[model samples]
Target: MNGDLNERSTGRQRVLVIDDEPAIRETLDTFLSWEGYEVATAESGEAAVKQAKEEQFDLAITDLRMPGMAGDETVAALKRLHPNLPVIVVTGYASDEAAMRCSKEGAIRIVRKPVQLEDLLSLVKAALG
Candidate 1:
């Protein structure tokens, strides 16, 4: 798959990608864009919260650790703003505890970093549904 998303389904979905790493954010933004998703990127949880408050998104993909608000907080904030919105938490530090915590915080899924693009795309599709 080369970690690239090239297929486009009908009715493009809007996705917000929140991560501190520029490379991760940009890469995801580009890949998802190419996949025909309306993508938005935020470098910090605070910024993500602000953006979510200002706009609507079908799904949100966020890093578990970040400078401003952290993924858990961001997910909570998003839930407050949009209760039905689905969130996916991505983390390099994949642990059972962290995954459980994310689930407790309302994330639809928790994906470990260096993620396969196909897995992510699949999760996004399921979340949107």
Candidate 2:
């Protein structure tokens, strides 16, 4: 899958992909788009917040360690905007504290970096269900 998402069909589930890393953002955007999801990418937590407000996303996948706001902060802000929104946290720097906090605040799952697309697809399906 490439970064060109204009060819995708509509009416599928919309997913927001948030990551400061360009590689990760593009990877997820392409993967999700290939899986028949409508994908939107954001490079920062602040940008993600604004995008979330402007669009209706069925799910959000965010990175934990970002430049300014970070995943937790983004999740918190998103919760305030839409309490029932499902979020999945993907991070290289995983910790018990962060996982517990994310669970407490309402993330559907917290996946470590180097995740396999198959496993992630399963989680995404379950979360969306």
Candidate 3:
């Protein structure tokens, strides 16, 4: 799914994408990889944390809702493992409370579902930068 973007110049930044839905995971993996990011995906928050321990990632994009270890918990766990790791939380059920909670848990951004690819990319770039 790698796109036309050059990885040598920019350096392929590894990105962790966590989502329970196969479609969502595929979408992020394809788009991010196309953008020249080395991407890894997990189907649950628990798996995401486990993956994080195994590999180093520049950034993480995760679904807010999941079966075990919710998005906020996942973000917290990631931070615990890597204090400065940046996280972007995406959810179909965006809410003020959820956003605030995620923010408090160390998420860099909380984006609602149906997020525009460009917008997500921009946020990712900013986070990586």
TM-score of each: 0.88, 0.91, 0.90
Q: What is the C-alpha RMSD of each candidate to the true structure, in Å?
A: 7.1, 5.2, 5.3
Per-residue lDDT value at 94 in model 1: 60
lDDT of 2: 0.87
Residues 1-129, model 3: lDDT tens digits:
133233233568989999999999999999999998999899999999998877778899999989988998999999999889999999999789988989999999999979999999999999999
TM-score for candidate 2, please give it. 0.91
Q: Largest lDDT belongs to which candidate?
A: 3
Candidate 1 per-residue lDDT over residues 1-129, each given as its tens digit: 221232123357889999999999999999999988989899999999898777777899999989978788889888899888899999999688878877888999999878999889888888877
> On a 0 to 1 TM-score scale, where does candidate 1 land against the true structure?
0.88
Give all candidates' CA lDDT scores.
0.87, 0.87, 0.90
Q: Order the candidate numbers by lDDT, best to worst.
A: 3, 2, 1
Which residue ranges in model 3 land beyond 4 Å of their true spot?
Answer: 1-11
Compute the lDDT of residue 34 as modeled in candidate 2.
93
Whole-model alpha-carbon lDDT for candidate 1: 0.87
Query: Which window of ten consecutive residues has the lowest lDDT sum in model 1?
Result: 1-10
